[model samples]
Target: MSTAVTRLFIPRDTTALAMGADRLAREIAAEADKRGETVEIIRNGSRGMFWLEPLIEVETPAGRIAYGPVDSQAIDSLFDQGLLQGETSHPLCQGLTEAIPYLQKQQRLTFARAGITDPVSLDDYQQLDGFNGLKKALQMDGQAIVDEVKASGLRGRGGAAFPTGIKWQTVLDAVSPKQQKYIVCNADEGDSGTFADRMVMEADPYMLIEGMTIAGLAVGADQGYIYLRSEYPVAHQILNEAIDKAEAAGFLGDNILDSGKAFHLEVRLGAKAYICGEETSLLESLEGKRGMVRAKPPLPAIVGLFGQPTIVNNVLSLAAVPYILSKGGQAYADYGMGRSLGTLPFQLAGNIKRGGLIELAFGVTLRELLEEYGGGTFTGRPMRAVQVGGPLCAYLPESQWDTPMDYESFQAVGAALGHGGIVVFDDTVDMSAQARFSMEFCVAESCGKCTPCRIGSTRGVEVIDRIRNDEDREANMELLEDLCETMIYGSLCAMGGMTPFPVQSAVKHFPEDFNQPAQTNGAQS
Candidate 1:
């Protein structure tokens, strides 16, 4: 009986659960009972490949035979068709899951543990190479851990490419006799076209906990907080539960693993404000206040969160720490080219047909990801502009597709791989409309602290209208450019400053869209 136990993993993300994985689990168990197949099923998170929800795996002679978008009703037919041995008549039988080019091409470093193990199971996590980093860190001094991380060449994966090791060393060097040090994980990823953070949190909560635990040990931080956005209510619930489990098991809380290290962690919820994704705004939210961006110069590393020295990092930044510590920093550092080092968990989202998460090295090009990896736009129409990063990022044309995806590579070409989100749009999409939407999104989500962001965003929309209506189109275009310049150089934070990135990139890439514009039903022209 033990030898016959074939393990199968079922995606249990909220979307999958809603689509009926829970009932399907029961059905699989019952069907195995009638068929006399010794199969053990474990629930895991999506591969960020949402189109394949309720994804089911069957232990087979050839490997795991996957059938997706599956529900309870289909389980009987699956078992009857001998799917356990890889023979299936099910319509959803996507033969040979590993060979699916989209899933196969990804490097899957940070996501190596995802979609493969029970998310909350400590045993499963450890078996799949989880706590090797924390164990390694426990054997080293605080500064040593910081030094190792410094060599990894990992930067903030949230957007800004600040070095994680450098940030930790600052908190370590800070004078805090009467002061307390904090480890804050920025999980408030409000950036559209990005769900890499959310996927990590849900797929492997233990990885995040282990990552944060390592950060706390390195930075002399006893208390840690994960500032998760409220929009990700499902992820918030999953991580919070995992935190409780970890605390009970002595992996978290005081005297962790009897190492005499007093470390405790908590989860702080964000209230759907986009600004909270910023570290200062996140800190403000943690302090029971509105999410407003704070001034810099005295960076968060020096003075932050209840006036204490804080080591704040993005979700992916911390998640990558475990791998860096386990496999020497040089191993992780050697992956990328030039300034951008280590592997990146790139999210292929929006209009793309094969949209999902693709982890790869820094040197890959936009064209490879969009054409080869993405399988073109979802509409099967000619792919128009592709937006790398989130809404604040630029809408670039095919002319820039050959450009590499490294930090300086994208930036040199006037685009960014912000949060590693690649949103594609087909030929039908008008850059002018998307550019206008960028300003509109800013107007809706800005924290209203800075005058330019609070006011300029609304005006930017009006100016975009002047061009869209073709009312002195060329003049309006110049005025819009000037307004963008003001917002870029004048605004306090990225809310207003980066709004120009999408707008100007749109006009630069597709000037024909703004020239002699089309008339809507309500247009005065």
Candidate 2:
């Protein structure tokens, strides 16, 4: 008689690996062998509950039970306490995986398959409705597919908040002389404290593939490219592997599913440039040119990527297409508040406990995420400032924390929910220095193609230094504001345009920081 084999799952995501998951996996196997028991280990993606990384799930009659932050040293104790049988008596046992409050509360539409299956398994992907969107898109006309996206009320999740469907419709309606169009997925996610795009690429790569394939069908594009950041070595490898697997299974490449419709996809590594996160700059980098912003008149939809019409979208926006196609547009439209339909995967990071990804509907307040999901600051100090969006975004005070997280709501408060990267800061943070760093960051990353960004950022830094040093403080403060206006309106791209957001917000919300007494040796208190 054959003995029944026990199944165990450990995450192979970057976070888990950083926490020594591979070592833990080896130890578990050795312990099982010493006991003469049969065990199967499956490396799955992370569930985004980063605090409990290397979370091991044992398949039981009840369900997958969770135990986490597990190390090699704990393997012996865990097994002795009936870990294989999903016993909850162990100190590390977190009960059933699905019942965890952090994971249970998330809507998880785009991230549905994330952490639930093997990252590169095509079978695992198909079993969970992976290519259903592409299957449906193959049957519908291009116009119909575009219409579905329009009705879904989806906007760009890459911080711009532009209507995605309208951009698709533009590409669909554009006339290409060379009969060529492109679908570019901006995977160069350079925003500070953001890892949602990397999580999708590493945890559920096929979702991005399926979403991009549907985009090809919707916009009549035959080729797609994922401009991934060079920093993400793991994501690059996994994306390439998933693409190979998908193509072999007939989900990508020419004559997909034998429908005679063709779509080919490839992954290209980007040069380490923050400016490349901008769509036009990304296109320039893809074309082997200097990554510089292109002026808008003939939008990318009409003229892009070797001068052919192109559809450029963030990874989350494209990843969302699969769901919009599978469950009708209105189905997705039913989730969020007015205009900001569908769920957003908010990535919590910085000085916060319980930091990870939380996908919720639009109307959720920032206070809810910080308090309930974040559980307050990791240092246990009073929370001071919160930077939503990226380095270019404003530093919000406690008063603005109550605002809803949608595009318009954030916009109304002179803030943005850019890429859903929320970075927390404790009371020890120096707001004036942070504001200065924003200008300095622009100086370091600017492409020098525009004067406002290139020169204004350098001057802005000098002015902020003067303010901090108490050198004609009143005159310099006024000069700083005037210079910010120049950069805001005179810059060629958001690189220059949005640099003033953090500096202006710091002076507005935390004036005390800027008005501090001058230090003796440039030392900050």
The best candidate in terms of TM-score: 2
lDDT of 2 by residue, 1-525 (tens): 333788899888888888889888998998999998889999988999998988999988888999987987788889999988888998889999999999999999999988889999998998999889989999999999999999999999998989999999999999999999999999999998899999999989999999899999998999999999999988998999999999998889899999999999999999799999999999999999999999997899999999999999999999999999999999999999988999999999999998999999998999999999999999899899999999999989999999999988999999989999999999888887888899999999999999999999999999999998889999999999999999999999998999999999999998988887545323255
Listed in order, each prediction's TM-score against the native is 0.94, 0.97
lDDT of 1 by residue, 1-525 (tens): 244787777877766777787888888877888877788888877766666778887766677778887877777777767667677677888877777677887787899888777788788888999889999999899999999999999999989898888999999998776658999999988887888898899898888899999998988899999998888877887898899888998889888888999789999887778888878888888999988889896888888888789989999999999999999899999899997999998888888887778899899988998888888888898988888889898988989999998999888888888899988888877677888889999999898988778888898899888878777877878888888898899877888889899999998988877775645322122
lDDT of 2: 0.92
Clashing residue pairs in candidate 1, if any?
A: none
* Model 1 lDDT at residue 487: 86
